[model samples]
Target chain A: MSAHAHGTQHFDETKRANIKFSAEALTTIENLMKRYPEGKSKSALLPVLHVAQAESEGWLSAEVMDYVAELMGIQSIEVFEVASFYSMYNLRPIGKCQLEVCRTSSCWARGAEDVVDYISKKLNIKEGETTTDGMFTLKTVECLGSCGSAPMLQCGAEYHENLTEAKIDALIDRYRSEGTRKNYTDLNYTNSK
Target chain B: MSRKLLLTHDNVPNLHTIDVYRSKGGYASVEKALKKMTPEEIVEEVKKSGLRGRGGAGFPTGMKWSFLAKPEGVPRYLVCNADESEPGTFKDRYLMERNPHLLIEGMITSSFALGANTSYIYIRGEYFYVSRILETAIAEAYAKGWLGKNILGTGYNLDLYVQVGAGAYICGEETALLESLEGKRGNPRIKPPFPAIAGLYGCPTVVNNVETIAAVVPIVNDGGDEYAKIGIGRSTGTKLISASGNINKPGVYEIEMGVPVEEFIFSDQYCGGIANGKRMKACVPGGSSVPILPDYLVCKTATGEDRLMTYESLSDGGFATGSMLGSGGFIVYDEHQCVVRNTWNFSRFYHHESCGQCSPCREGTGWMERVLHRLEKGMGNMNDIDLLVELAKKIEGNTICPLGDAAAWPVAAAIKHFRHEFEYHVLYPEKVKDSKHGHKEPIMPVKPAPVMA
Candidate 1:
């Protein structure tokens, strides 16, 4: 894993300079900071990461993580470690629509496997592997605390549950067709919604 | 209908003040512990009570406290592992949010027992509201002279702080939590010098679960021997089981240890049986990390004893037959649920949360997830079953932390208990169509590209 980091060119300082947290992100960080007493802005690391990841197109970059570290007045490595350590904060670029499939035990017994298999085959990529077209990335995640609806997957933020091959196929077809229509119309379709 | 122990009076009239808690005999334990008992006596009481770590591992809490290296003149630390990241587990969140003072009282008592002057509560990142609740409660405790220097004029000074983790499941591991607390990466450090000996800035530290710490208050208040008498041998005391999924009552239910699984699941006193009259299929008795127990094995074990929710009884048949009560995440599955798809979903979670710290975990989790993904998508072959097992084995014990084991146990258990599901996907590919979102194409072909070197 360290080797992958070695060959990749280090992020340029100019790229780092242009990375600015949006107003919403800054406000969320400030609110989280108030949760702690004075002189403990570092306590906001996780909330800051959450806001940053949300603002930076659903994933985090090394430069953005470093910038968060600077904003929180902690070591850059501290922020990097957190971003890389968690499965939620994506370090690299992800597909336009990220599929978070809950593969925990309850979901597993509820036919989440079929949903995953259906999604992967439909998208033409295995888990953790994004499609060449960059439309979707197939990834499996742990329980998203929604065990009541087993066999569930979270696309962007909305959860689609009781998933079967047919249900998954239709959902994907709708998203794909919607993407194509938006492309032709030049309408900005926010995938998260 | 009885008064709630933790969150009983969240809706009670005028119940949020320190005076209300005191009126209900809340700080009586703190006053008694401070005025009467010595720190050693408190630790001995806990030891006598048979209180175990409520944080899934079931380590003896008193034994853990004893493990602290006591080299004279060296400072020791106490850290409450509030980083409750276990899947299907949310009891700690409720405890912090509704009954924050219970945890604060417990922390103070536990800290006094450990002879620590400073402590921290490492809460999960997503529990933003709970963190604020704890902070306010801490301020309240400080105002009452229970947390700050010379608490209640006991001369034992202590300071407590709340630290938030960056939402990594691995940080729930004690050592990784310590590392995160120190403003470092949340990776588990190799153990030898366990956290008890050298933790949290290289001092003797005791990292305990929130429930474990909170239990201390009750134990110390009621006297350890009295508390020990409540439950069966070794597993004495009550445990908070977060029952969810296909249950008539889905919430944190506190029951005395050694309650039979049949009672816990089917009894009106507990989970109130499977929801909507669905037949029980399987159960992840513990959190998502433990193996799944099929309906046949969910009953009494070969010991001719009904499976109880206690740590020992739950582990009776090991992973081969019985599941653990780990973190007490009781997730029940109805027969309508597909085992293959459920396992696939769990595999995806492990793969995503692998942290890429070790080769086997990083690569193996990804591999198992992909194979399971294919099987779910109806693109699996018979060989893929063997490959998934092999990949899980590779990741099982080959990582820096137990996160690898956490990821592999579910996969291995799923395949063990539900092999036919994998076979079903392979045999009837047409039945498992594409995801509802897109064209029906194979996600992973019958064969996948070899993991990148």
Candidate 2:
């Protein structure tokens, strides 16, 4: 019996009823699980979580984590510990477009702060805050290995590199009009440089 | 103007396609490896080639392969470490993005040599597009009979898949990569029974960097002796340098091991000199983990000998005035950039990335970050410098992984080379508070050592 503030740890049966994967997503998870040897289907947990995140509302809720564990036939804490460890698995809700700007050494050396400031001003949101309309969330992440093209950010699978004010403006307007939740599982994603 | 073993056909149209890659003799290594040569012979060739691990450790690739234990029906594995999250390094992504099939071809040939029936390419999660690109290529490889079930009719059954990590820089370490792949927390395991003996569900496994696996293609096609003859001394073959930060041409470059550092920095073929026409201040020749070298030591060693890109020449001064060619992440800094600030930024990164398994790295990196932040913000006394140096020394060899050493080296090197800058921030707080980027170079006092009080 954990408190409600410890949302990821507490398992609510009503919330569990809401967890459902699409037919396509279920197939993807099953195929991923089959990729490993027998009884080691737990190895598919990371990839399955990716699929679960994409198929859901773009974050891992308590129910979603439990469903993933149950779906993989493991303990709920197994999924909870892993989701908490990695940077990509968003435990709470995020805006549709997650702008992960690189603020590490190379990117910082080449004006990554300016890029972050510009986006925060344009979206009228501070770093780690979401816009009122729920279209954008600004985050400053460490290096995404796009050092050659410094001052870059990742939205879903799209890599917006070589950031300028004009480029960021165009990116904001583009995502604003598209109005769809962007995610890492977007297979058709492209580098919008 | 260097020999391009990996990216020779980079500009070729449709190079990403299987037909074009095969037309250029792509799968020739697999054919030679599985169909003709014995597994032991292939290992011997790689040992003769003298290629070191391109992922920063500089361990001999062939020696590593030779160490794989083969005890009675235990399935061996070859996992390609595509977790390329090194701050100034992105060559693995570039190689995989540009020529996906080359890595696949390398995987097949290497897997055959190691007798691994199933293998995986563990790439970073943020590179979802690159994962898609690799998945497409792997699918193509399997379709063309280069990956699964008796590849090239050599009775070699193999299965290859691309596994993406969520986002963890620590996963780039081989054991941690295995841990993540096994669907667990990526805390790196202690060594005694190394990965070669006990890895990937208690089976023998050989983990290699993507570039290391891809280089196997050229090594098998041409004889290892021929590959060994390409570069200078023990640092054999061409290496991909991921050049970034304050440089005009900041991209990946494949250079012969003997290339002079001066030419590589100034030549139009490489970095094309410092950006904004600014005077060079410093450079981290390897990734952020290695020691940072000042301008004077970058092009030439402390002994007045010209610095070459080889492992030996880059590390000639032994961490006193020298650094390693680690991961080939050539990050340059100009005069306007502050060493103390950059050191702070890097310490912040290591603090954020330390897996927190070991106490010294966990606590030491946090202390170093806070002290560097105070020193950078012009809010500290001079004693903070000595404290940082002491903390780094305590943390250097105290962790389970090299990440502790990685976190320690940059802070120690920055203080060793730029103590005057830290003192300037303390002595002239008003001058530094507004302009942390770099408020003019500091003029040292007649007395070099700081007053303890």
Best by TM-score: 2
For residues A1-193, what per-residue lDDT tens digits would candidate 1 score against the true structure? 2211221258678878999976656766666565443565675676567667666655677788878888888888878766766555677767667777876665655556677878878777899876676667777876655555567876654567767777788878777776531110011111101
Candidate 2, residues B1-453, lDDT tens digits: the string is: 799999899899888889999999889999999988999999999999998999999999999999999999899999999999888999999999989999999998899899999999999999988998888888777778887787778789999988889999999999999999999888999996899999999899999999999999999999899999988889999999999999999999999899999999999999999998888889999999999988888899987899999999999999888999999999998887888888999999999998899999999999999999988889989899999999999999999998999999999988877778788878887777754446265332121344467
* Model 1 agreement with the true structure over B21-47: per-residue lDDT tens digits: 666677767787888999899999999
True contacts kept of 1: 0.33
The alpha-carbon RMSD values of the candidates against the true structure, listed in the order shown, are: 9.3, 3.8
DockQ of 2: 0.53
Q: Evaluated on chain B only, what is the TM-score of candidate 1? A: 0.92
Interface RMSD, Å, model 1: 9.2
lDDT score at residue A175, model 1, on the 0-100 scale: 72
Worst-scoring 10-residue span by lDDT in model 2 chain A = A1-10
Give the range where candidate 2 chain B is weakest over 10 consecutive residues by summed lDDT.
B442-451
